[model samples]
Target: MEDTEVREVTTSAAKTNDPDGRRMQLLNYGIQTSIKKCLSAVRYARIEKVLSPIAQSSPEILKQIHKQMECQLQTNIMDEISSMFEEENISGLMNNLDKIIEETSLGPDEQAWRPSGDPSLDVLPHVYSTKLKERSSLEKILKEVEDKNRQLHEALRPRQQRLETLKKDVLKECQYWEEAAGAIPEDYKQKMEKFIRT
Candidate 1:
């Protein structure tokens, strides 16, 4: 009986440690790894599908797209600059150089007023000094104008608000009168019309 029991235990241990079971586990692991690889490949194929159209596009088409994007960017930049100019009230203050030139009668003929040749080094300092004086005077005038504009805006703010309020009140009154008029009896309206005609 001891020998039979020992043989049964050894046989059971051998069955539990079978090489076929290990082989099957290895085969399942290989299959799972291959499935993961296939899924990754499919994802890569999808990415390639999205990129292929752009890659295959003609050069002219690509250039057109680039130009359109560039144009839109330029337009947006111009709009921003225009808004800044307007907000700063600089657009209204800007002098048209061409118009000023025409009004001043400055042309190629006016070049004669300049030195016949390149100005001497000695004259350059005087010219620069004169230009600096003019620029300073212009800047002072601009500062004064800006100050006046700010003061005027401050002064008008209350008046503008009052006007807006008055307008709203007038509208309300008008609406109330319209409703009152609509509610009048037809006979009363006719009587009032007759009285007005008289």
Candidate 2:
């Protein structure tokens, strides 16, 4: 019986393809793919973290920052001009000139200058233009993000199928080993088990 079982095992092993080698290859590929995905996720998370403030800021806050930057630039320019001319009153003169220009452009009731009709159209033309551009840019970014997500899902579909196949193959291999173990003599099985444990 032992001789017969040993011959059967050898015959079965000889007839089959190298499933253990294939399984190891698949396992290694899976591990490498997982590590690559983890690295990609980490990179994406870092980029998102860096851009989050810019993406999440309100338009009003952005506008305020723009205004502050312009003010700072103007102040710097005035300082430079004042230093170049060696003039003490140039700063005050520049401020007065700016006030006069603003008054002429905006008039007494700046609110009256707003576009009449739909409340949405009441905003200044330049402000509305900037808002429209911002909206389109955000929409474009959203579309691109959606397209990338869809592409990623499509790309992973094959890998997912392969993983499922690997799982089934592993189970089948386990079943084959269990059947072979069952066919062994009790004393030999115990010895095999002890060897495996050690």
Candidate 3:
């Protein structure tokens, strides 16, 4: 406990000596953590959203995926999204990033959408549990953007298929009606013609 206290004090003093530097480092770390969590939640939420449609719809797999994200890639992914967001001059707050990105890409779900911008998955681990890096590679930076792009296209594919099926059904219905109308009674046609005031 004494050693922990001493280390914290030293860290505090170093941070106090260069507050701006500390803040920037902190901000970068925060963004990375937040984005990672956001993406993981987004991915899991996607699994949950699309389970019935996809081949493997196990909540266990979803949990495993989320756990893997937190254990391995979450920090790295968040860093990338944060760096990009900062470059775009988007605010780097993590609390809202998850929900904002979720809403931006997935639109909304009935049980989970929050008008205040909070995400639906509260069971996931807390983000922003540590400090941040001040800089990172551009190659490393754009990974999240690409991942997000892929996610959007995937989500749209099923909806597009449904639309195509609907169009085919409607066209078929029209054809059926046309064929039925062609077989109309001769008497009805004669009556319709007489209404022309022959």
Candidate 4:
């Protein structure tokens, strides 16, 4: 009874994870089929070589030839597997698996799967909430900084205009004084009189 129940449960789990199961099955099937095909090809090549005219009809020579063929077949299989991995770029998959293995082996205190003692350290919610909080804080800080910059610009606008006006007034006064001094009719008394009036 227990065995049947366990079998039913296993079947239900497999059904639920059908996609993962299918992927694993397909990979296994491909590897096994490739190996079988390689063996068949090697067998055919050996038979052909044995029947060929160049085949020295000696047992030792035949054995050496067969050994070379097997090595070649093994090399071909390795090449095929390597090509498959290269095409798929299995490095990322390997990295992810390594992370999973590392996580699994970590101590309870360090594992992210389990709670880390603090209520705020709950896994999924905490991670997402922390991210959201950080995002909102950044946006808030950016907005405040922009507002302060705008306020500073507004405050400086009138002061800048006032400074420009003061500069123009000073330049005009200087020019007038220069012209009046140059126009002093070679008479120091007239110049002193004008200066006293101003």
Candidate 5:
């Protein structure tokens, strides 16, 4: 009798654990798949944004595309996750996501929607973590480019100022010579002759 009860208990425990373990595995797989899809979409959007002449030419359109893509990805991922929840909850969540996409696509004036308050969506932050790494790398490159630009600008400033001063002096001297009966000034003529010989 004791052996039979122990076997039954063991079997029941295995049955319960199996379903939970499978559920967790499925959940993990779902999250990973969603992140991969989102990242792939982002990559495509970036490529399109870079390669398209319209996006390259107009900054406003690029910004709008960026905003729309961001909202679209978030909404897409949420909609996927909503499938795991109740039917009623799914519709409400989807409606909220649609509203958010519309608002984001329209402009910044609309009320922003966030997933931070939802505990079940914690995995979504990982998607942005990858973006943050890329952003940091890009920021480093941008800083280097900006520093080089500043150095180039600084190096050129004194030369530019000197050239401007020399040009003004030359113009004034030319005007004086012109007013003085069109004959080249003796001192200026000697400088021009020396410059030509050099």
Candidate 6:
């Protein structure tokens, strides 16, 4: 019989309560429960310690520590520069940004060189001429964003097309298993796994 049933019978046999006997019974039950709980808790802690490193290293466990750390570091730096995008402060940023710039010419194989426009096109429009331009309207902001998106799409077009072609080729090669149990032979089904996960 289980512990509770044994304890019930023990109490029934002792028709009268000797305070000492009742106290001892309660103490025994408490000690037994505590021991069992401690053993179970220890098992869980040991298992977690064993699995923690494996889980951390696994690619399937996305948003892992390394990626989150980089994201948080970048977010913090940008947050600290809250006022730098302002019209008056924008000129100040150009000097600091310019200092960080390293000018270099890329050879054909190096692939990084892209020159800006025709020198014969003449005068460039000056920004920060101390004449304040009004803050952009919501419509203008949306239009600028759309135009930038169009440029990004132009740059990504070939890569995106290649990705789609690659996906199709991979899918063509990958064998798709039939999921229906009805399609499986009864002899095999009894001995083998009933389902095969694709």
The 0-to-1 C-alpha lDDT of every candidate, in the order given, reads 0.64, 0.64, 0.63, 0.71, 0.69, 0.56
Clashing residue pairs in candidate 3, if any? 29-132, 32-78, 32-79, 36-78
Best by TM-score: 1
Tell me the deviation in Å of residue 112 in model 1.
25
Error of 6 at 189 (Å): 4.4
The TM-scores, one per candidate, come to: 0.38, 0.33, 0.26, 0.31, 0.32, 0.20
Tens-digit lDDT string for candidate 1 (7-66): 555465458874323223333344445554644453433543565676466545655655
Angstrom error of the Cα, residue 110, model 1: value is 34
Q: Considering only N, C-alpha and C atoms within 3 Å, which residue pairs clash in candidate 1?
A: none
True-structure RMSD for candidate 2? 45.4
Full ranking by TM-score: 1, 2, 5, 4, 3, 6
Task: Encode model 3's per-residue lDDT on 1-198: one tens digit a residue.
Answer: 645654555477576774323334456555555665666566666655766444254667677866776666665765677588678755435435645665677534646544545554442333323212323444456887889889999999999999999999999999999888789998997898899977
Give per-residue CA lDDT, model 2, range 1-198, as digits (tens): 645654555455447853323223333344445554544453433543565776376545655655575566556655675485355654355456656666678555565554578766665665978989999999999999999999999999999999999999999999999999889999998898999999
Query: How many clashes would you count in candidate 3?
Result: 4
Candidate 5 minimal-lDDT segment of 10 residues:
19-28
Q: Could you report the Cα RMSD, in angstroms, for every candidate shown?
A: 42.4, 45.4, 33.2, 15.6, 30.6, 47.4
lDDT of 3: 0.63
TM-score of 1: 0.38
List where candidate 3 sits over 4 angstroms from the true fold. Answer: 1-137, 185-198
Cand. 6 Cα-lDDT: 0.56
lDDT of 6 by residue, 1-198 (tens): 567765884486456644334434454455455555644453433543666776557734433543564456545645554344354564345444544453354555887534457544322334433223434465678899999999999999999999999998877666344446567888997667545532
